[model samples]
Target: MGKPDAEGHGPAEGLPGLPPEWGRVVVPDDASALAVEATQIRRELRRAGSLPGGHQALGLPLVVLLVAVLTTLAGLLAVTWPRANRGADRPTPAPWSPPATLVGRALPALDLVDADDAPVPLRGLLPAMIILLDGCPCPDRVGDALAAAPSGVSVVTVTGGRTPSARPTIERQARALADPAGGLRSFLGQPARPGAATALLVDRAGLVTRVLPELGTSDTYRNDLSVLAG
Candidate 1:
């Protein structure tokens, strides 16, 4: 036995066969203090990878952030994938042609005949002004158009709906014709209205230059007729 130190405890003298590097071990008397020491040792061993069955526990905030990131990525893919694929895979459609209006275009293949059942040669009669009379005889307007026509311009009035037995006499190098089938109105796409007249000015090249929908004045006819004659 060794002599007592100042703390009134004897120095360690047992286990002399142990190596010099082995130090004295201490044990606490209280059970609670022993449990605390055991818990600290286990935690250190787990962190150092010396303990088995140890895994890191992710915090609630970290798990929520990961889930949000994945959801955002999925949403981005859903929104953009179809648009990219459509631009790459689908062929664009061709532009549509405008509706058939005679202005700046050649006349369609038409077979027109006069009231006497004689075939009216419209193609042959180029550089002409055609006045379409709707729902009335419109003799005064027809007369004004015939008189105002320039020397080379031919005035042709086409009346729709009926074939009267007493037709106006074709005078002043103008021809009074009738379209009982409403074929002329359909060809020109003119809407039917009471006392509404439409004027079409055709050039020498068989291309319609101007289309006046509501023919108001004879001066309109005169100006377009002069242009047609020129």
Candidate 2:
């Protein structure tokens, strides 16, 4: 501009038109400024790399929530599974029937007293024929059936209540017994209906082999007894 400067250069602001050798002055401040600019650019790149955006940021929390939900459902299923299976596995019991035929069933304990007030242990009288009749005066047919029962079978007649006079007559035909407590009805699992004669045939092992219900004539009693003997 005004005869250039000492090195034939105009002003520093006119650097675009300067010769290459004249512009080659080393400046320590320029290198420091460039280093600072480079550091700022590196920092911006690192911040962009570290920060997650869009779906990547949402996916992490979603995965954690999914795991937690799945775990909760699994825990609930484990607790209720056994109770559901237990109710499904249980079986209902069969209904009870009165006078349930005791044939082929073990005879329960029967402790009775004879007409003479002696204890008659029914279990001890195994392989015997027991005739259960209504209250005494024992029927003539029942007494006759007990007397006519085949050999090798001990016969005993059980009455519901005590009858002092009927005992002697009944004992003449068979061993007379009295269940003052009405226990035989409970043992037979049957209600006491009038004039129903029930005969139980017990084997040597204290198990009842046959149950005979007789509401008919004397011939029917004989036939039932004959079958019991064999």
lDDT of 1 by residue, 10-116 (tens): 54233233334444322222224345545755565567464353333333434443444344344334333433333576778754322346788776545556666
TM-score, every prediction: 0.50, 0.47
What are the clashing pairs of model 1?
Answer: none
lDDT of 2 by residue, 1-230 (tens): 11223344443232233245443322221223336545754665566567777356555645544444344334334333444434776788754343556767887787878767878788777667777776224467556665567875667778877741243344445666778787766777766555566677787677777666553444655655565567
Off by over 4 Å in 2: 1-101, 135-138, 162-172, 221-230
Backbone clashes, candidate 1? 0
TM-score of 2: 0.47
Instruction: Report lDDT (Cα) of residue 47, candidate 1.
Output: 71
Worst ten-residue run, lDDT, model 1?
24-33
| Backbone clash pairs in model 2 (N, Cα, C under 3 Å; residues 3+ apart or in different chains), count | 0
RMSD of 2: 28.8
